[model samples]
Target: MGYLLAVAAAVLFGANGSVTKIMMEAGLSPAQVTQFRLLGTAIVAGLVLVVVDRAAFRLPRRQWPVMIVLGIVGVAVLQATYAAAVQRLPVGIALLLEYTAVLMVALVAFFFFKEQVKTRLWVAIALVLVGLAVVARVWSSELDALGVVLAIGAAVCLAAYFLIGERQVAKTSALAVSFWTMTIATVFWSFVSGWWELDASVFTQPVDIGGVGGELVVPMLLPLLWNVVLGTFAPFLLSLAALRFLPATAAGIVASSEVIFAFAVAWLWLGETLDVVQIVGAAVVLAGVILAQTARAGKVVDADLALTTGPITTVRDTAVP
Candidate 1:
């Protein structure tokens, strides 16, 4: 169930990038989209955090800096950058790059965090590379440089998210970390958004619900609601939980399913389809990620195999990538 929940979370989380694309098309600015995600996530995740960890919500004085940084670099940067990337590239292509966080985290685990890797892992990564090559079609004549750069930037943000989130999981419950981190992210994102640029108009009501703080005032918020609920709220909570046991890198590979989901969702909802060359390119990007994910902890002990493996031990385990 935990693994299922984690994968489900990855889907929701992964889909957010595509969701942002839809919202933007509906006439939301990048900053506006980010504002909704950051604030909406804060409200949803914050409520859950308060209910689950009300007793432990407050951290010591020293932890505030850590929380603030995590909020800015991890949540804010990741979501904002991803939104920007999808605005330019095909959803599947953009996603293929960003999900490379799995590889980035794996490498970090090896040389920095020092985690283990097995031989089969390398083979899997190699397959990923081959698959991505087929998907992206590297030999193609056309190249979208701007799209590629934005995608790479998104991946960088995801890498930061993994590294920072891993650090917090050690001392905090996933719920607590997610809640506080989200709250902080929302706050920072708001500051970046500037109060003048934000308005209630960003959220619209095509229909009405019952009542709220005053009169009957429910409105059509499917796009916005999904943004808050499935995209922002659910993903953060589940990922925070996953971070407790899974290393950032392994979590990343599993999360790579997001790439598959992105393509599927984009096609289903947006009627977008990938051509052969694009598919090949996407495969190549994923290939790099897999290679990084499966690489071993040691330097160069070249024998018969590269001996690539994923993280060993629980969150408790650490080694060179």
Candidate 2:
């Protein structure tokens, strides 16, 4: 069930890319779109918390600082960076780069926690790099360096998301963590957006309120709301649940499916097509993800066992942060 939930988490995260792109194309700046999305998500997550887990929502005073930091880094920065990256980079390419947070976590463990890296681990990383080369069509052309940097920044922020989530996974409920984090993010985004004048060109029509236009005038689509609900809230909640059941690195690797799933969803929904080379690259990325998961376990049977039987017991939380 945890494995299925983790995969579902990936799909939800993937779906966000295509949907967010649509919203952006409608003229919303990445920051504005993210602010609106986060605001809506905060409302939903908060409602769920008040109704289902009110007590958990109230952290002790000592934990407040930790929660605030988590909210800033994990919730605000993690999402803001990704939205900005996707605004400039191809959604698939941007997402693939972001998913490299899996590797970042593993490296964090190796260098900081002194965990051992095996031969296969290195091979898997190599495979992913080679695969991404094809996916991004790097040899075909060069694009904006800043766009690439944003993608890398998004990946780093995502790594922080996992690392921070892990810090509280054992002590906190996933529901609580998600709810509080979103709440903090809402505060953070509100401040960021308070001074900025919203542009009128961000949507197809002026925003309607009771058949009236609001002062801001930014409009929206039905699908954009659906995107906020499913793409943003649902998947992130599932990821929090996965964080409860798995280590940061493991959750990250499993979540890598989010990118490939993004490719498929974009192809189907947004008419964003891919070439045979890109498909091959996606395949290689999947292979590397699988190889990396197995290599970390130190035994073929354990790896196969994990894939076949969901997350086995040996995929421990030790040394994971």
lDDT of 1 at 192: 69
Candidate 2 least-lDDT 10 residues: 302-311
Tens-place lDDT per residue, model 1, 1-321, is 445655777678556666678766666667767777667756665677667677656687777887777767766766677677788777877777666555555666666876676655556556656655555455772436676676667666556655655565457655565567667767777776664664665566342221122334333366778777877566655654555655555554565566777787777666668887666656666566556654654321110000000011114323223
RMSD of each: 8.3, 7.4
Candidate 2 clash pair list: none
Q: Would you estimate the TM-scores of all the predictions?
A: 0.74, 0.76
lDDT of each: 0.59, 0.63
C-alpha lDDT of residue 203 in model 2? 39
lDDT for position 46 in model 2:
74
> How many clashing residue pairs appear in each of the predictions shown?
29, 0
Best by TM-score: 2
What TM-score does structure 2 among the candidates reach? 0.76
Q: For candidate 2, give the lDDT.
A: 0.63
